[model samples]
Target: MSSHDVHDEHLPAHRSETTPATEPIADPGLPAHQWRPTDVDPAAEKRAERQVATMFGLSAVCTVLFVVSYFVFEIGEVTTTIAGLGASTVALGTTLAGALLFIGIGIIQWARKLMSDHEIVEMRHPAASSDADRAETVAAFNTGLEESGIGRRPLVRNSLLGAIGVLALPVPVVLLRDLGPLPGDTLKSTIWEPDMRVVRDVTGTPIRPADLEVGDLVNAEPAALFETDEEGEPLVEGVELQVEKAKGAVILVRIEPDDITPGPGRDDWGVDGILCYSKICTHVGCPISLYERTTHHVLCPCHQSTFDLADAAKVVFGPAARPLPQLPLAVDSEGYLVAQRDFDEPVGPSFWERDSR
Candidate 1:
C-alpha cells in the first residue's frame, strides 16, 4: 500500500470511543433562480436589444460631432463663452464625453438586460487547476459567447462595432493639427537687436554699469518691450510679447575683474565687471536665478543644474549638457548697458536640428 494508506492503518478504532460524538452540519444549497422579464417575454427581450442598439448609435453620433467641433472651433480668439468656459472648449469636451459615456452605458445595458443571467457555483480548489477544470473553463467561455447573443442580435452588434470603429478617426485628425507648422528660424533668434538696451525686468529702467556692484545679480530684460509700452503702441503684444520676453530674459551679474574668465572672442562682452547671460536654463528651459555670489555659480531650481557664470556660465554640477548662451554686451553713449547683438546661439533647451553639446 501507499504511504498514506499505511499512515491511516496506524489510527486506532478505539479513538472514537474516547472522542465525544457530534452531529455533522448539513450543506445549504444555492437559492432558487428567478427568470427576468426579458427571459420570460419575447417582446421585453426585443425592447432591451433595441435600447442597447440605440445607446451605441448615440455613441457613434457624438463621436462624429467631436470630430466636427475640432475643426469648427477657432482657438484663442474666444468668440463665445458659456458660464466662463469658451464655446469651443464646451462643445469639444461635451461631445467627447458623450461618446465615451454612451459606449459605456451600452455595454452595461447589454450585459444586464440582454446577456446570460444563469448562476453557477464555483467551489474552492487548488491554486493550480486540474485538466478537467481547464476544459470546463473553455466550455463555459464558449457558452457565454453563445448566451451574449452577438450573432442573434445583428442590430446591437453592428452598432457597437461601428461606434468603436468611428471613435478612432478623431485621434489621427487631432495629431495632424497638433504637430503644427515648422518653427523655421524662430528658435535661433530673439528680439535682442543691436543697441537694444538691457533694462531691469519689471521696472524697465535702463541699467548703467554703476547700477551693479561686485557679487550683485540682477534680473534684466530687453528695453524694446517697455519702450513701446510708454509710446502706447507696443512693438510686440499678446502671445508674441510673452514669447519674446521668455527668450530675451537675461541675468546681469558683476564679478571682480580678477575673477572673470571670458571665453574666446568674448573678452569685451562684459561692461566693466558686469556680465550678461541668458536667464533660461539649457536643460528643458526652466528659468534660473538662484545665484551663489561667492562661487559665481547659478543653480536651476527645477533640476539642480549648476553653472559657473564667471567662467562663461559653464555647467559645473548637474545634468545640463552645455553652458548658458552669453549675450554680447556693450555700453551706449548714455553709459547704459546694451546688447552688442542677438545671442550668437539659441537661448533655451536643445532641439532636434541644433548641435547643442
Candidate 2:
C-alpha cells in the first residue's frame, strides 16, 4: 500500500480543506474482500476441511516415524548412505521437518478457508483497563473461539493435538542423554603443586627475580604445560593440558616492596619486588594482561575489569566483585621462581565453594 493510501477512517475531521492538491494525502477506503472457492460452494468447503485434516493426520504419521527412525538407525552408523548423507540423518531430518511443515500448512488452511474475514476500525482509548473493559475483552475472546470452529471439527482438532503431543517426546530423551557423569572436586584446584617451577608461557624457561625489572609484567604458566615423558611425548596431553593451563595461568609483576599491601596471612606470598597472581579475571574468567605499569594495575580486555597488582591484586575498578587470587611465590635452590604451594583460595570465576571462604 502507498504511504498516503491509509483508510479514510484513519483521517481526522480537523484535516485542512485548503491544503494544496499535490500535498493532500490520499485516503483510500478498505479494499474489497473476495470470497474463496470453498466459501461459495458446499462441496468445495467440505473438500478444503478434509484437506486440512489430512495434513494434520500426515503430521501425526511423521512424528511417529521420527521415533521409529531414532532407534532403527544409530547415531554413528554410517554403513547405510542415502545421497552421501547418513541414513539416520536423512530419516530423522526429513520426518521431523515434515512433522513441523504439515502442522503449519494445516493451520494456514484452517484460517484461510473458515475463520472470520470481516474488517473493523478500533478507535484509540486510554491504555489502562477497567472492569467493563475486562468484561468486553473476555466477550471478544469467546466470540473468536466460536468463530475458530474447533469445538465442531473433531478430526482437525484431534489430529493437530496428537501431532504436537508426539513432537514433544524427543526433548526429555535428548536431555537425559546429555546429562553425563558428575564432576567431583575437579574445579577446586589446578596443576600447581609445591615446588612447581613458574615458566614463561610460550618459552618454557623459568623466571627469576632479576629477569623482571620494576614496573614489568610477564605472562607465565606452570612448568607442567611443557613437561614430557621419556618417550618424548607430553606428560599431560590433549584436553587435560588445555584445561590445566587455562586454570594455572598467572601474571608476574614487579613493584616497590613498600608498595605491596598484604592481605591477612599473605605477607610472604611475594618474593622481593615480584608478585604472582592468577591471570583469570574474577568477573567471568577472561585472561587479564593489559597492564598500566605506573599504577600497578592490569585490565581485562574482555570487559575492562581492572585489578590492582601491587595491593594484593584487589579489585581497583570495573565489574569484578573479588580480588585476583594471589599464588604464593618462593625461590628454588637453583635460583628459579617456584610456587610455594597451590593457591590457598580457588582461582577463576566464583563458584558455590568460593562463597564459604
Candidate 3:
C-alpha cells in the first residue's frame, strides 16, 4: 500500500479514542532524465544548424532591401497597384515583414534542433535556499551552457550576430526620414490673407458686422475658399481645398466694444467689437464651438479646454497648453467683416524642435 493509504489505516476508529495526528510526508526525488533526438544524432544536429543559418542569412538580405527601398520610391507615389495598393508600400511592407519573419524562424529552429533538448526533472526545493543550493544552481547553468554547444558553433553564433546587427541599420534609417524636412513656415501661416472677407462656414455667405448680435458666436471661414474663377469653377477643390478651409476656420464673436481688450500692437484689429480667433483649439486641434456669453469663454468639448475670448483667447482653464491664436480683423469698404492678416503665431500644439515664427 502507499504511504498515504497506510497513514489513513492508522487513524482512530472511535470518537472517544484520542490520538496525535501524523506529520506531512516529504517529497521523493525526481524521475529519470530523457535525451532528445539531436543529442544522439549527428545528422539531425547538422541539418538543424543549416536551417538556422539559412533563416539568419535571409533576414540579413531583407534588412539590406529595406534600406534600398527607402531611397528607391517617392513617398506619395501611387503607381503599380496590387488590389489598388502602391508598389512602394508593398515592397517596403513585404521586405520588413520578411526581415522579422526570418529572424523569428531562425531562433525557433535553433531552439528546436541545435540548442539543448534534454528533458530534466528537478526535485522541489525549500522556498529559502542555503549556500549549497546556490552553488548547485550555478553548476546546473554551466552544464546547460555546455550542452547548448554555443561555444563550439562559431558559424551559427556569428551569423545570428550579423543578422541582428544588420537589423538595427533600418531602424535609424527610417527614423532619419522622420527627421527630414520640417513644417518650417507652414505652421505659422494659414489661408487667411489681407482683405479676405469672413464668410459663414459651409453656406459661403459673406458676414457683415450687423449680422451678429452682442452675445452671438458664428463659425466663419476665409472668403477666398468660396471664390470661383472666370470660368465659374472653384479655385480650390477636393482634399486640398478641405484641408485649407479647416486650418483657416475661425470664430466670430461680437461683444460690447468696451468689453473687448485688444493686446499690444493689435488696437485696430477688431471691427465694432467683433473679434475673431482660430476655431482649432491650440491644445490639440479640436474644433471648438461651445460659447458662454456671460463669461466670454469658448470651451473645447475635447479635453474641456476653456479659452477666454474677452482676454485675447488666453487659456483660462483645462488641459490647453497655450492661448488660442487670434486673427486680426477689419471692416471692408462694403461693410463686410474681413481679416487684416493671418494669425501672428502658429495655431496648434507645439511639436518637436518646432520654431513658432
Candidate 4:
C-alpha cells in the first residue's frame, strides 16, 4: 500500500452515522427514610443511651483494671498461665484491649443510635475552598455538634470523657518504668583493659601479630569474655557478657608499615603495622568489616560509612561523624596481641549524655 493509504488505515474510524449519542447516568435519589426503633420509641432510645454509657463505663473500668494488673501480676517468670500464655501478659493485653475496644464500641453505638439519623447528599465541588466555604464549614461543624446531642446526653458525654481521661493514665504508667536506671558511665567504658588479650571472636583464641599478614582483618574481643574468676566462675556471663562483648568488639587489621599515618600520640598504638579498632560503626553502632585491602578503607554495610584504617580509622566518605575508636595494641609475655589500655574515647553511636563532637 501507498504511505498515505497506510497512514489512513491506522487512523481511528469515525463514529457511525446511525449510532445513538451516549446519555449521562441518572442519579439514584436517596431512598425513603426508615425510622429506627430508638428513633420512634422513647423506651428504646433510653435503653440505647444506657447501653452506650455502659460501654464507656466499662472502658474506664478496664483502664483502672489495667493499672491494677500491672502491679498485681509479676512481669517476669510465668508462675501463672492462662491458655498456655503468661498470666501477666494475658491480663495486661486483655485489659489494654478492653480499654480501647469499649471506647471504640461506645463511640460507634453513640453515632449509630443516638446521633442524628438524617441522610443528605453532599454534592462534589472544587477542592480549593473559598471564604464562603470556610464559613459554611464552621457552620456545619456547629450544626453537627447540635445534632450529636453531646450537651443533651450528659451521661454519654461525661462517661466518654472519663474513659478517655483514664486511658491517658496508662501512658505515664508504662513510660515511667522506662525512665529506668541511668546508663551511668557504661557507654563511656567497655570490658577492654590494660593487658587484656585480644582474642578472636566466637573461638576465644588469642590473636598474635604474626597470625595476620598485610591487608588482613580479624574481629576480636577482650579476653575477659572467656576468662574466669578465682572460684572458676566466668568473669563475664549471661546478659552482662553479651553487653560487654558488644561494647568491647574490636577489629584487628594488618597494613603495610609505611601505609599507616597515626594521629598524635598514636605512634605506639599499633604493633608491627597491626592496629585494632572497634567493630561497631561510629555512625549507628552496626558491626562493620567490609574491608578494601587496596585502599585500606573499611565500609559499614549499614549506612555506607567508610573509614580509612591506615589513617587512624578516620571517617573517609560517608555519614560517620567521627573516627572509629582505636585500641592501643601490644604484645604480652606469651607473644599474643593484647590491649595496652581501653580506648581513650567511647565507641559506637552518639548518645544524649556524650558530647557528639
Per-candidate Cα lDDT values, in order, are 0.89, 0.85, 0.84, 0.89
**Candidate with maximal TM-score:** 3
lDDT of 4: 0.89
The window of 10 residues in a row where model 3 has the poorest summed lDDT is: 73-82
Clashing pairs in 3: none
> Tens-digit lDDT track for model 3 on 239-303?
66887887899999998889877777878878888999999997778999999999899999989
Q: Put down candidate 4 lDDT per residue, 127-244, tens digits, no spaces.
A: 9999989999999999999999999999989999999998996746674764644455776888888998999998999887889999899998899899988999997887789889
Q: Give each model a TM-score.
A: 0.71, 0.62, 0.74, 0.72
lDDT by residue (tens digit), candidate 1, 1-357: 999899878878885357677889888776888889999999999999889989999999998888888778777855666787787789888988998999999999999989989887778988898999999899989998899999999988999999988887774666476775344566689999999999999999998999898999999999988866555887788988898999899999999988999998899999888999999998888999999999999999999999999999999998898799999999999999999999998878866775522
Q: Considering lDDT, where higher is better, how would the candidates rank from best to worst?
A: 1, 4, 2, 3
What TM-score number comes out for model 3? 0.74
Off by over 4 Å in 2: 1-99, 105-146, 150-186, 351-353
The root-mean-square deviation over C-alpha atoms between each candidate and the true structure, in angstroms, is 10.1, 12.1, 8.3, 10.2
User: Which model, 1 or 2, shows the larger TM-score?
Assistant: 1
Model 4: weakest 10-residue lDDT segment is 175-184
In model 1, where is the ten-residue run with the lowest total lDDT? 175-184
Off by over 4 Å in 1: 1-54, 75-78, 81-85, 120-186, 229-237
lDDT by residue (tens digit), candidate 2, 1-357: 666676655777767345655776688878997778876888987887899988988888888887788678765424567898788779988998998999999999999986766777877778998898899899999999998888977777887787787777773474365473223455568899999999999998999899999988999999989999999999997768988999899999999999889888888888998999999998888999998988888998988888888888888789998899889999999999999988877778766557413
Candidate 3 segments exceeding 4 Å error: 1-51, 74-78, 82-85, 122-158, 161-184, 231-233, 352-356
